[model samples]
Target: MLGGLWEWWRRRRLLVDASFAAPLLLLAVFYQGELDQGIYGFPGVGFLGYWALHAGLLLPLVWRRRWPRATFAIIALACFGQWLLHVPLMAGDVAVLYGLYTVTAYCSFRWSLAAVLVTLLGAVLEAAQLANLPREFRWAVMFLSAVCVGVWLLGLHMRTRRAYLRSLEERAERLERERGNELQVARAAERARIARELHDVVAHNVSVIVVQADGAAFTLDTDPDRARKALETISETGRTALAEMRRLVGVLRENAHESGDGYAPQPGVEQLAELVDQMHRSGLPVTLTVDGTPIEVSEGRQLTIFRVVQEALTNTLKHGGPRAAARVTVRYAPDAIEVRVSDDGRGAAAPDDGRGHGLVGMRERVAVYGGRVRAAPRPGGGFEVIARIPVREEART
Candidate 1:
């Protein structure tokens, strides 16, 4: 209940306004009473008129923030009018200090400085008038001047602090937006990568299955034994495609199951021979040669090499003429691994705009390992793809 009441009080603007106005109103009343007792001589303004002026000076403070410059102007004018009439200063005159502070805190700096100067002049004038009075009251000008400067300084400090806090909040919001944008970009790149992997795995195997199925159907009556062999090749190709598809699907369903059963290790350079045999069965005569002793390679870099070779051979099968043949070479160096896949096909005649998805995927994969890839038509009649990937000793182990 107390928390609810506190929240209610905090939200009520009228209560806040009254909190400030009531105290000054009581001070004005007290000063009026003192004047009535003949403690400070008035300038012939009757009791009612003096009280009315004091009320005007003190009540406007309720709306000081709503109309800061206007409120300060009204209060300053009232104080100057009272001084011009030679009325004795009262405690109600202290409201001018609050007016100066409000203008500095809520209004622009130029207006606030203008109020400061005006208040300073008023203080000097009051001091000049009281200068010839008594020794005990001579400190009035210095005291009022100090109060005005101190209030303005406090208001300026508050304004600077509020601006600084606002800037910090804006900076935090900007960084959050940038972080969200970076995540979106990363997600998009990953999705594209998965699409390319699926394409490389499925397209190659499906193409071979289609070719073997056609061959089996064509030779079934004329050569029963050859037809049986083609059927067997089709079955093997389909199973390999299915296994790869399951692995790709598992990657897509990440975190869906914790058993790790759905995931399979990605193919690497060690599987290059099996890949070449598959292509040979698909009626593409392909050969692989290795130079230098084999070295341990990170799974990621190995995958990059495998994909480069797979994509090159897939392009050859799709676009290379029936008699096309391919050769793959891997050279291991102390600091790098190099792969080359070249096909003696009708590549120069194949229509390609150099923007095929397979080529783009190969480049993206190689770039992940800070590798360089080149794919271009050879001078005579074939297509060639070469990739060189740098390796770190730690990664090799």
Candidate 2:
């Protein structure tokens, strides 16, 4: 119960109203007799007039935070009116100092400085009238000056502290928004990579299957043995394609909150020979050569190399004529690995507009490891794709 009441009292409106009322109640009880004495140089107003003036000075403070300039103006006018009428200072006069502090805290610095100057001048004028008591007048002016300056400085300190806290909150909010944007961009790039992986895996294997199936159909009656061999090759190609597709689909399923326990591992550099053999079985004879000692490569970089080679050969099989042949050369340099895929076929020029999705995917993959690729028609009569990928020494065993 006490805690609840304390929270209620801490509210601004309740606290302001209470501050206005408490002084009025205290003055009515303790200072009524002194006020009634009507000392010389003080206003000779009756009880009703004194109470009216006191209320006018203190009541405007209730809206000080909402209308700081207006409230301070009213309080200053009241103070000047009392001085003009020669009214004695009452307990409620402290509200003028509180009004000045509020104006400094809530209003702009120029307005607060203006209020300070006016209050200081009023204090000096009030002090001058008491020349008969020089010591008391000096002390009074010093005390009033100290109080006005101290309260205004305190209000300025509070304003600066509040502004610093607001800046910190705004900076935190902006950083959070930037972090959210970065996360969205990362997710989009991951999805695009996954799509490219699926396309390269499915397209290459299906094209081989179609070519082998057509060959088996054409030779079914004339050469039973050859047809049986072609059917066997198609079965193997279909199974490999199915396994790879399942792994890619499993990744998608895992991302969608499904089981991914049976997924296969991604192919890398070690599997390059198997890929070449598969192409050879599809009736596109290929020759692969390696130069210099092989060094250990990161799985991601190895995958990039494998995919580039796979896409290049797949394009050759799709576009190269029946009698075409391909040569794949890999050179391991001290600082980089270079690959060249050349085919002796009816080579056509690559599109100048860069609209080929397969080439785009290869470029994107190579770019991940700061590599470069070039695909164009050879000078004589073939298509060639060359890629060079940089390697870090620490990435090797």
Candidate 3:
């Protein structure tokens, strides 16, 4: 029951009505004589009469938090009227200190200061009249001024502390949001890398197997030896593709453990020979050329070049005619590496445009390492794909 009452006092509209009503309740319960002494002043009206007067004056205080200036004015007027009527001195008027503090914390600085000065001046004069001290009684007026001033300064400090706390909370919340965004960006980049690997592995290797298997079936009756060779090539190419794919995908598993020493090494340009052999055995006439000494490149750039070549060959097998032949050339330079893949096919002679996942994967790969790729029909004939990857002077590939 007491908890409920306390909650109501803290939250209800009755707080305004009961701000002074509470004191009146106490006065009625405790005060017995018409004129008496208690915790409050005496020698005039009894404690009950003085409390009644203060409660009536505080009727306006219910609105203090809402209308501070009006409440202050009302309280000041009540006190001045009591002095005029010669009512016994009452300490209940001390509630003005709290009301003044609220006004100082919420109102403009100048207005709050002016209100404090006016109230202190009135309090000093009232105290001097009510309590007749020795000749040094004037010193009491100064003491009253000091007490009111101290209360006003306390209110200012509380307001400053509250504002400081609010600023710190806002800074912490902003930092949390920034950290979340950075994590999301990192996740999105890793996912795109995985997708490119998947397309290169599945599409390129699968296309080669299909072509080789078809040739083996066609030659089984007429040429048993050639048929066996085609079947063998299909088996070898499929296994190599699966191995490469496993290496790339292992990083994606949540609990995947790296080698005790470090991460696995990535495949680079040296692996192109094995790739070309797979296409030759699939019955596509392919030419391979390397101009300068092979040099090392970053894992990301190496994988990108490898996938571009793989996709180009896959497209040739899928779209090139029966007699189509492909030529692949890798040229190393002082500051960059150039890769070219072209096929003398009679089918739609345009190199893979940005259409199927094959072409899309190639483009995404090239873009990641700051490389440029151009796929178009060769001016003479057939389709051609050209890629140039810029490298640091000290870097090699």
Candidate 4:
């Protein structure tokens, strides 16, 4: 039931305000003549007198949001004046009651309480003057007290309810934000774990294959049969890597492979040479350099570096001038690997369209590995892309 009401409120906020405002507008029109006649009570005061007094009191209510304290003060004075004159409580005075209640609910408690006390005092004085009762036994006084106290209490309750609803809304929003943050953290951690596993699989397999291929090629001149055997081993190793890659991808629920192990080998830092060789064959002037002995990296960091280099090369091919020269340098230190890719080409210094997903992808990769990327135009006139990946393998896991 509360949910339905909330939905209604959300869907029709303007409608509710309009419905309340229309009646107030109508009341204003009906009482306008009375107000014109009763300004300072000009000649004999009639029903017009009471209506005009209340018109002033209620007129300010239209601007209650702008001047709440002043509106309530006007209402309290009008109500007190009418009580003293024995005006028998005009129907228009009901608007003053609503105004007083609104003031109490929306304004400071001290202000609202002061208004309530003044109204009660006026009610007491009127009852004492008009009611035929002894000072000891005054039912009229009690009735007056009840009326004033009841309005005040009702307004206070409404204020409390409003405050409670506001608190609940703020709390719900805080919890929603916390949940979103937790989900994002969990997702990032999972990706890092998968990346680590993939790196281990790729590096170990690729390194072994490259070693055997080199040895077999060296023997090909003297021993043809052995060379053939070595070539077959290279083929088998390639097939195994491909098979593992497929198997791992199969776990993603895609129907790429009908049978056999679904895991596939994912490339890592070990495949840097292979990547450079492919780009070389594709007609780009590419060079690869390594500083310091290679150290083990978390699968996640390896993947991030591989992707960064791949993206840098891809951008060069798409944007660089013909026969552009590009170089990738990886400096492996004790704690981190700093990679720098620079290209001497015309398109290198041009601005990116800002729509390419590659930049976003690179950022996400670096963010996961607790790394940073800087892509800018070099002082010598070309584009340089640099990525630094920390080597906290345990932290990545």
Better of 1 and 2 by TM-score: 1
Give the TM-scores of the predictions, in the order they appear. 0.55, 0.55, 0.45, 0.48
TM-score of predicted model 3? Answer: 0.45
lDDT tens digits by residue: candidate 3, 158-272: 7677678888899888877876675554455544555444445556667888999999999999999999999998997786565545445534433233334222344567788
User: What TM-score would candidate 2 get against the native?
Assistant: 0.55
lDDT per residue (tens digit) for residues 330-384 in model 1: 9999999999999999877987643346766677667655688999999988999
Number of clashes in model 3? 0
Q: Rank candidates by TM-score, best first.
A: 1, 2, 4, 3
Residue-level lDDT tens digits of model 2 in 1-397: 9999877877767466557657755875467776556443245566776777777778787887878788888878887877777776777678778788888887789999998998898788767764458888999899889988998899898878888998999998988887667655554555456545554656666788899999999999999999999999899878666644643542322144334423334587889999999999998999999988898765456777898999999888877778889999889998999999999987884323322356766776676566899998898888999999987622322
lDDT of 2 at 177: 89
Tens-place lDDT digits, model 4, residues 261-355? 33345567889999999999998888999999998664446767888899988888777777687999999999889999899876446656533
Q: Which sections of candidate 3 miss by over 4 Å?
A: 1-52, 60-69, 127-137, 196-397
Worst 10-residue lDDT window, candidate 1: 254-263
| Residue runs of model 1 more than 4 Å from their true location after superposition | 1-7, 133-139, 210-397
Residue 159 error for model 4, in Å? 1.8
Off by over 4 Å in 4: 1-44, 64-67, 83-86, 135-137, 210-224, 235-397
Best by TM-score: 1
Best by lDDT: 1
